[model samples]
Target: MQRDKAYVIKHYKKSLDWINNLRGLSEEQWRTPIAPGKWSVAEVIGHLPPWDMFVLNHRIPFLLTDERLPKGPDVAHLNTMAAKKSREQAMEETLNDFISTRRQLLQTIQQWTNEQWQHSFKIGQSEMTIIDYFVGLINHDLHHFSQIQNVIHV
Candidate 1:
């Protein structure tokens, strides 16, 4: 089912607000792992932007056109690369990159015509609306956000 654009946008905004809560953490806090053998908070922050960039540059464009949706990159490889890059950057820099990329995505989405929001795109054998794509994005953000929160609380 197609979700209302306004409702999806509201949830997206709420997710951003939750991410903003990370602003006050110190550098060490940002780098702390949520659990052994898991990603650190900065790496979790690192993990997010590539997907937003993909949605902005690839998925959204494909949804607006007749182009086949591209297969996603290998998750483990992508996350490993992102984690390495995140560790190399200053915590604040990594955080800003994620926020900036996400904001750009929001701006792009806000400009979409109602029809664009309702457009269906194929992913492998399944299909989903543009709003469903946004829902997936929000779910992704929350997943990492929860990881950060859990690590910080430890």
Candidate 2:
């Protein structure tokens, strides 16, 4: 029932690959400067956690909780905080959180229908559907994935 199963799965596979590639790196490798003054792989991983967790745990479920967007724009701040930690700590907790939440996000996507993908709902300032948010998530990942590769010199 996924509207575009091929498209979804393709991106899903690509995302999974990018995540896995990071996981395969050693702790030092993860913290290596991936870009000039951007963020290391560990920080990038830390940055990804909320994309899934906030969407699943707060935003979607809290459709009635409040109009406030969940896990809004504080991620850069969070990444800054996580970056302060040693690579070991960031990878263990922050990176793992991304893996956990992404697992949940993929699981959630499995239950969606094509129509459900774009079903509009009100949130904060504008009306958008789950699909819009999910698309944002995908794009965010891709954009950062590029940054990660650049930083890691991979």
Candidate 3:
């Protein structure tokens, strides 16, 4: 909630810890939908890695510079593919992907200078500080984490 680098890093690490500990979930539970017509738990978790990779590869490099940030991903298409893969793959694989990618993201965040964290940059028509950008992402993670918690009753 502080929206500082420390806070953002904490939640990112927390999310990884939460996912790593989910090995206890039954396969049926992993495959169960969070709600009717919504993504299954696995799908929800599976979608995270690509977004993390996007931040690592796309957003971070441009956020402190004047360069135009790359266009955001096609959400529907990416989620569709992620969901399909989640439904097809084992839960361990999905969780491992998340862990690996998220760890990379965390490492990158940890290396940022304070100015990099506080610097403002444009994304399309809008501008926000790098810390603010990460706060938004942390909120996104919280929303999905909450959805999964409700579905799995964990």
Candidate 4:
């Protein structure tokens, strides 16, 4: 699926607003699991900033270049750590972390040229455009957001 840079940027910006608004949720609600045997809303949101940082620090620099990309994060380990931190920290801390990292990501995205958006790059064995990469991330955000919404009705 083709994704416009503007659309992706919009989603990034909207995500900040969405998470910011979640400040109003009760502490219990913030900690509520999306489903049985699943992550709480805080865990889900907390996991996102590291991935954004990964994209900003690792993926973005190497994309559209001949350099071999660095290894991706260990997802399970990272998620586990983020979840543990989320469970231990205040809701405000989690929300602030999400907003800060997402804002950094959005700022980086705003500076990309059209060529950067559409040019194909090899990420490991898979080749895709910057837009394509972001579309996948956006879908991920949507999925987690839906889960959060379902549990909290916010």
Query: What lDDT does the true structure give each of the candidates?
Result: 0.80, 0.66, 0.90, 0.90
Candidate whose TM-score is highest: 3
Give every collision pair in model 1.
none
Model 1 C-alpha lDDT per residue in residues 80-138, reported as the tens digit of each score = 88899998998778878877987888887889888888888788888888878777777
| RMSD (Cα, Å) of model 4 | 1.2
Off by over 4 Å in 3: none
RMSD per prediction, one decimal? 2.3, 3.7, 0.9, 1.2
For model 4, residues 1-154, the per-residue Cα lDDT tens digits are 4479889998999999999889999988988899999999999998988888899899988886878889998999988988899889999999999999999999988999987899888877898888999999999999999999999998
- lDDT ranking from best candidate downward: 4, 3, 1, 2
Per-residue lDDT for 134 in model 4?
92
Report the C-alpha displacement of residue 95, candidate 4, in angstroms.
0.4
> For residue 45, what is the lDDT in candidate 3?
93
How accurate locally is residue 43 in candidate 1, as Cα lDDT from 0 to 100? 86
Worst 10 residues of 2 by lDDT: 62-71
| Candidate 1 off by > 4 Å | none
**In terms of lDDT, which candidate is stronger, 1 or 2?**
1
Candidate 1 at residue 65, lDDT?
A: 78
Predicted candidate 2 versus true structure: per-residue lDDT over 1-154, tens digit per residue: 4425346656766676667666667777887776676567776677666556667777766543335565465766666665665354756566557667777777777676777665676665678666666666677887878877776655
